[model samples]
Target: MTKEKESILDVKLFKRLFQYIKPYKGVFFGLLILVVLLAIFSSATPYITKYAIDESIETKISTDFLFYVVLMFVVLILQTVFQLLFIYYAAWLGQNLVMDVRVKLFNHLLRFKMKYYDNSSVGVLITRAVTDMERIADIFGQGLFMIVRDLLAMVVVFGVMIYINWRLSLIVFLMLPLLLYATRIFQKYMKRAFEEVRNEVSNLNSFVQERITGMKILQLFTRETIEYKKFKTINERHKKGWLKTVWYNSIFFPLADLVSSISIGLVAWYGGLNVVLDGAVSQGDLIAFIMFIPMLFRPLRQIADKFNTLQMGMVAANRVFKVIDTTSQIDDTGTYVAEGFKGDIKFDKVYFSYVDDEEVLKGISFEVNAGDTVAIVGATGAGKSTIINLLNRFYEIKDGVISVDGIDIKDVTLSSLRTQIAVVLQDVFLFADTILNNITLNHPEITEAQVQQAAKDIGIHDFIMSLPNGYHYNVKERGVMLSSGQRQLISFLRAYVTNPSILVLDEATSSVDSYSEQLIQNATDKITKGRTSIVIAHRLATIKKADKIIVMDSGDIVEQGTHEELLKKKDGYYKNLYEVQFLQEEVI
Candidate 1:
């Protein structure tokens, strides 16, 4: 939830964004040269007009006038060519820069610890990756380069105006201070407004995304009207944020135009007076002053608009850099690679907390020898799942060490450590892909034959073949095309095909029909044999065959033994839990 706080014109942020431009320096410099040419040619046209009027038309030289007109037409044609190149190259550079940034950002997100995602909104991240990136592209394509071209053109216009007649040029210069002041005020207010708009945009995206994803839940609870009202409130705020920008634009642009018009009128009135009375300012000079005033002042007005674009890009850049600069990723500095895990794991005095000063696992110590099936049975919130998450290195421990095969997990590479373990959760998630792809996860080393044999081994091969296309059948998003039991079966096949040394099933059989449970039970028996497995289940009946049972209560291990040994104890936690489940089963 933390955001980057920096100045509106933070030079450091600009330099960081500029690093992306380094890869395509050739295109960028070429674009710059094109912009320079555009500026020179654009400023030349008005001056050429001045010369044609004074030397050809005013002097009544028909042949000279024809030549100058043709020369002006050629200048316009060449300017058009440069403009085309500038626009094309600028857009190409912007698109390439954003593509690299989007890929890099996605890679960074992949390495982040689960803790970061637990606090961040998926909708906000989507906005950063999609919407905010578009704004960044504008910085290069339409913001900075265009502003530079306009400023350079304005400079050339001013230089020509002074060279023509200093007195008339002074008239135009007098209005600049006021225009600059207005522009400065406009930019200051606009920056604040832009930041508000971005924040609201993120909020709106988050609200809409969440509502759409959870539409079923909303309808189930009959809270559609309530959710609609909430969305309306967020949408209204987004509208107001945008309206502030509009309000500022409404006030600033007219003032700028009024100043532009006044400058032109002053130049005309003074230059006409001089031409009529003393002929100090010629008719040609007066006409060019009229042309030059807009050239000089127009960029000043356009600069304000372009600067707003630049400001929005910078705002987006700041948000993006915050994600890139985040240090919440798990440290992968360990050089050791766990080649063949023996599946022996030890958690020594481990303590962990998702939030500060609120420990979920308090000095919980346990061990699983190689090739042992250990069942961790506990009430909800007793940290049964937390242990599985820690074993996979999904969250870092605050205290103590977790070791696999006598090597501390933190000292082994994450990929090497995780590859050796496979987990089947109560909630199974499969990508929108074919059944074969879901099982193999597109792993290059896992072949179709291996997946098929694994499916047959797990006893789901017939169930899959009964589907529309067997292994090739596409399961839509989150495997919604399949039933809950079918999804769970797919997960089992996925875990089995991995051939992992350690298997963890966290409430994997808790949410299925009796028939599916039987299939899962059969699959479980095939997969867990001679492999180190940890089963966390609410149904005590399924875990009775485990080699060892560890009973937990309120983050502490309360009992540890095999099923028979624990049941033998009078008023034991395991005995009481077994009796409760036994009664529930009998009643059913």
Candidate 2:
């Protein structure tokens, strides 16, 4: 469960929440008016009944009794009309409020730095956006406003009972202290119970999302039984949390009903004696007190449950607002737009770390001149990818300046800087969409013909034509419908279509077969021509034609030269790497 502190009935949080309703104030006020009208009609019914009975008890044909019955019937019809309108408008307001919140949350997420995503769980975020937002909608639909209406009805009923007979009203009022005490205790514990339940729900969602996404790995390792046991453990916690709330409900509601029944019994016993012995209370007044007792206590009973609903909604809103208030985003304060960029990139004594004091790139400095292709060759975890990520400002550098064309890249707008660069990562991610949509990413400027031409230029047009619908063929979630090599080809086509000024291939061809590698190599040459390029590769043979080679090891550049220049050294890092990889390729 999350270790965050649970908040109860936070007034400031509610004050902040009401800001979302500002746009729909007219609908909100109209709903309140309906609640008041409904309460008046509903609370007036028993008094009308008392009037009809008391006036007609002495006469067989009293027109006053007949008139009161018709009046009560008309009141019911009006109450029903107001109730219908209240339900419809309340739901409308709730849906509109949630839609606004969901959009704002999504927009906030989009601006967040990649570091935020690195530390956050996908399932938790999804729960905040989808599940938690629904709870917030319940605040308007069935939570705070509904509680208001019920309490208003209770107040009116209590006032009418006092008007009918102050003596019987006192008996009913006496029952409140006991039920009120019970309700207070119930509300306190129920808030804690709801917090546990919501935490458990988030935990379950996280576990399920992770397991399903990695199901292939689990099955390959034959750990299904082990995973199943883990799942059962999490599910058990969720069940326990819910059962605690159920237990509280079972205890409190029955006690409330008992107290209500006791109030009616007391009223009957006392009022009947007065009617029979002293004539202090009439038969109509006694009957009206019975009706009023339930009306007064029912809302009291329901308010506890409804208040819990309000508390849960508040909890959900707190979690979502935390995300919206997050400051983990790249500062795109620069207004300089990189139009017709020459792509002269430089990293000058840069330092970076994903975690505090654990540097991944240490005082590394390099430059890529206009139209030059620079290849970075290193073993795994040698800070090759870190350099690419820094160049794109996916993360802020710890202690250095990175510049493009002699100006700090931080001074350039993120959109303009990124628009000129196209990257093909080793692990390509495609949406559950058609090939054409994935390639263009639904950009209005890039037409289908442009994508086809780019595919043809990259030597993968025929491969695409072989699919079911060519460019229109769906590549399920994360492009699972295609093989690794085929996905890489699609990624290449995506990059080619962008016409970026600088091209980056982060081990793009490493995951593919020899045939796909050859195809990607051809595509690489076509795109990198007359464009500054950075290629990180484990395969030394693939980058033989690079304008320059920077060999890195343990977060530092150990050597920098061309392939032939480095190979001439008898004891050089690149030479040793080339010899080992050459022999390994031959063995394979």
Candidate 3:
């Protein structure tokens, strides 16, 4: 069996947890009051029988006895009515409590930096926040009130037994030590098993998500047999975890039954012998004694199961709190945006790395004037993307200053800095929604006519209209409904709709066909007429028309000049890239 870790919470969790409930204190007080009332009513059931047997059965017919019987009936009816009402409100309050927590967790995750998402997985983050939060919520919903009910009932049940006959009560209570010992052992085992079960579930979810997304890849490589074999390994691990749980659970039930059986047998032997030999206990008291034994021990049995539930919930709570506990190291404190951007982009002696002791960008420096088309041409993994990412502030600079419009990008608010910049990345992502919605997300209030005009100028409107729903077509996940060239065209339109002052196009037209390229080139030429445009592409055909060409290698700028000026340096990186794609080297 798997070993259970220590409880998820310490003293600190209780203090932090209470703060979230401060606004709903009144509802909690009402719940506590109802729990007390329910417990009191349930605890009185044994008492009513004791009185009926001891007094009413002896006298046979007295006005006092009749009046007591009627009173008992009235109490039962009142208990049932109020108990139903208690359930309704308890459930309502529990739902609202979980709703509040879910909303807070989601909003908090959004506030964290992109780096947080980069380092975390989809399954782990989702399971912790959603499924784990629900487990913690069960404590307040069903478990809390049940604990109070059983506790109150135990005390009153014991009092009734002692009053009916103290000697018999003493005999039945003797098994308390053995019961507690057995429970502690079983609880330890079950908690560990459940934690393993949770881990296995997480693995299953992660594998399932990956398999679905990469179904095409598996088929492409003809690796279905290998994939199936790998999946079996995960499945076996999950089954082993479950078997440990099942085995422990199977042992506990029989052990609980043995304890309960012994308790009952001991009560019967003592109660029966006393009546026959010494007249110490009456027949009526014996019946009530026997019935109350199960009532007493049943709650204890449930406490064993409930405590298991409580601890399992706590394990989940730790995972949920771990997410809430994460605080982004990077935050934007500046609240103002530059009134008018001069498009003066400057990077001064920037040094950065994603991993320690291994630099990605090493002391890179460059500057671009307002309304200039700066094209960066370099080999793969030459840190071209790193420069674009730094400008977007997706990753923090270890040392150096990246300024926009003479203000440090770090000093400006993230929202404002990103708002002024527009990026058309090589990997074009589109939500499964209408074409119009995808283009206008950055400017949702943009007129439909404006959207069509933008698409028509980019030469994709006619192709889009050829589809059944035209602009209203569902894009499918990641725009799978459209071809690569078609998706690239729409991605360009999205950036155009934003109307940003600084536009970053990373391999923007690499996927588009030649026919669509001239059209997109015409539209892009019009949009970048007065805007600062930064283009990063290996294709010399695309960057040849740029006002300035920057050639990069090993995260450092090797050469910078006008296209004609760079071409004059015959052996330079730009000149080499031009020779590779020489067929389309002409800039229209």
Off by over 4 Å in 2: 1-7, 586-588
lDDT of 3 by residue, 1-588 (tens): 222245433446546655667678888778777777876777566667667776777557564677667777887887897688667666666567767777878988877767788787777777877777777776566555566667777777778778778888888888867777877787777777778877887787778777878899999999899989988999999999989867876877677778778878888898889879997877677778778888888787877766666666666766677787888646777666755577999999999887788888889889989999898878777888888888988888999999987888888888888888988888889998888888887465798888888777656688779887988888988899887767777878888877688989876565668876666666667667788989886455557678888888877888999878877896987777776664355543
The candidate scoring highest on lDDT is: 1
- Candidate 1 lDDT score relative to the true structure: 0.89
Give the per-residue lDDT of model 2 (tens digit) for 439-503.
Answer: 99999999999999988887899999999999999999999999888888888888889889888
TM-score of 1: 0.96
In model 2, where is the ten-residue run with the lowest total lDDT?
Answer: 1-10
Q: For model 1, how does the per-residue alpha-carbon lDDT over 1-588 read when each residue is reduced to its tens digit? A: 223343447788888988999999999899889888988887788888888888888888877888888999999999988999898888889899988998999999999999999999999999999999999998988889999999999888888888999999888899999998998889888988999999999999999998898999999999999998999999999999999999999999999999999999998899989989999998889998888888888888898898899889989988998999999989888889988788888999999999999999999888999999999998888899999899989999999999999999998999988899999998899999999999999999999999989989989899999999999999999999998999989999999999999999975655678888888888888899889999996555556788999999988899999989998999999889888874577466
Clashing pairs in 2: none
Ranking of models by lDDT: 1, 2, 3
- The TM-score that candidate 3 achieves is 0.91
Model 1 lDDT, residue 322, Cα: 92
lDDT of each: 0.89, 0.88, 0.77
The model with the greater lDDT, 1 or 2, is: 1
Q: What is the lDDT of residue 266 in candidate 3?
A: 86
**Superior candidate under TM-score, 1 versus 2:** 2
Error of 1 at 197 (Å): 0.7
lDDT of 1 at 520: 88
